[model samples]
Target: MNLNAIKYCLRQGVVSLFRNFWLAVVTAGMIAVSLAILGGFLLVALNVGQILYNIAGNVEISVFLRDDADQELIRTRLDGLDGVREHTFIPREQGLTDFGYALGDSALFAGLAGENNPLPDMFRVRVGESDMVEALAEKMRAFPGVEFVDYGEELVARLLGVTRWLNAFFLAISFLLAASAVFLIVTIIRLSVMARQEEIGVMKYLGASNFFIRAPFFLEGMAMGWAGALSAAVALGAAYHRLAFSLQREALLFFLQPVTDPEKLWPVFAGLLALGTVMGGLGSLVSVRRFVRA
Candidate 1:
């Protein structure tokens, strides 16, 4: 179409919004609430995910070595182990020093200083999967020169269980939210079509092409969806930042740290906007099918 045709379509779309002001508001409000709920849960899931990552990061296996073990060979074997991310070697003297530090004073280890160190040489190995930490530890024990491997097996297993449940819960909630949003959009668009039935018939009788007759309604739906998405984005962004800042201030809640940057949320905002627009367009198309032959 030419510039004038485009302008006319745009004007019609804008005018429709005002003509049915209450309907526009209601539709937009429903979408905004739905998106806000989805966004809120999404933020919670992300923050919780960060916490899980922190927990997993803090878990590492300690592989103690025999005094006569070949440190170089053990290191080489560790490098080849599946799921191993990294490993740090600790000499017997350094292990003693670390033990002393843990016990809090030189007096705690005065009798076992320097060459008198009784601690075994060890390796701190970090694995890629928290759930696999215990399995990896058991596997490490079977390796040559490995005296024993310990990784707080019970703790890692419990943490993995919690994280798995959290992920499953979020996925279920997300599916429900998406389904509800789609149903609401379809119903609202059907009501909108019925409200504008007379005008649509008049346009059809005037020989206007189906595309021209339907363009305004489609744009109207998109306008409402876009407005809702924008509102939800603003609210969610503000709330996320506020919560993140508050949580960060509490040392005990450090593990629950959230991503507060608005710039980082652009992709999420974009996804919501796209989802809104697509739902709106689909709803309008489905609702207008009957009027097409008018």
Candidate 2:
């Protein structure tokens, strides 16, 4: 196409927007609302996943030992364990003292400091990965002198399960929202084509190429979709910023801290724009092809 042709196509594309002003507005509005809901859900899933990740990282296994257990044997076995990252041996005395300090009254256990201390000697073990916690705990349980191993096994399993479920749910929601947006775009573009059928037919009779006839509709669809995505991004960003700010100020939500960095969200915004643009182009291509013959 020549410069003149390009200019004409561009002009026609822009004109199409105003030609169906209400339709365009409605299309853009639907896109914006759909994308906003998807983005909001994505943000929530991300924050929840982060919280679970942190908790998993801090998970530790406690191996309680009998009073007659050989300290050197236990330490050697722990050092040789495949998934063991580190281990700290807590003598009965230290364990009692630590327990007392945790209770916020060290004096409460001062009398039990020596022989009266009921706390068993234990090894606090940190695993290299969350998935290895269960296996490592089982191995430690079999170690000589090990009375029992406690690492909240059921809790860790539940946490990992929840993370997997959240990921699956997010993917399902994303697919549905994207499909709905595409369907709406297709409907809007098809209506525009139907409204201009006579004009398109006349241009075809005048020897206009298919590309020449299709360019305007394609551009119009893309503009509508992009406009909607941009609006959604702005609205969602503002809301997320306010939410993060409020979360930071609340003590109770300290553990549920959100993604506070605005820069991190740039990629998501870019993705939304790309998705909208692609959906618009595809919808227009599919809609116009039926009426604009080669």
Top TM-score model: 1
Measured on C-alpha atoms, candidate 2 has an lDDT of 0.88
Candidate 2 C-alpha lDDT tens digits along 1-294? 799999998999888889999989999999999988888888888787678777887889999999889999999999999988889999999899889899998788888888888899999998766778998999999999999999978878988788889899998999899899988988999999888889998998999999999999999889988998899888998999998999899999779888876676777788888888888888788888876785
Each candidate's TM vs. the true structure? Answer: 0.79, 0.76
Candidate 2 stretches with Cα past 4 Å from truth are 1-5, 62-150, 206-209
| Model 1, CA-based lDDT | 0.80
Clash number for each model = 0, 0
Q: lDDT by residue for model 1 over 124-187, one digit each (tens)?
A: 9998878778888888898778888888878888898898898899879877876676667667
Model 2 pairs in collision: none
Model 1 is weakest, by summed lDDT over 10 consecutive residues, at 285-294
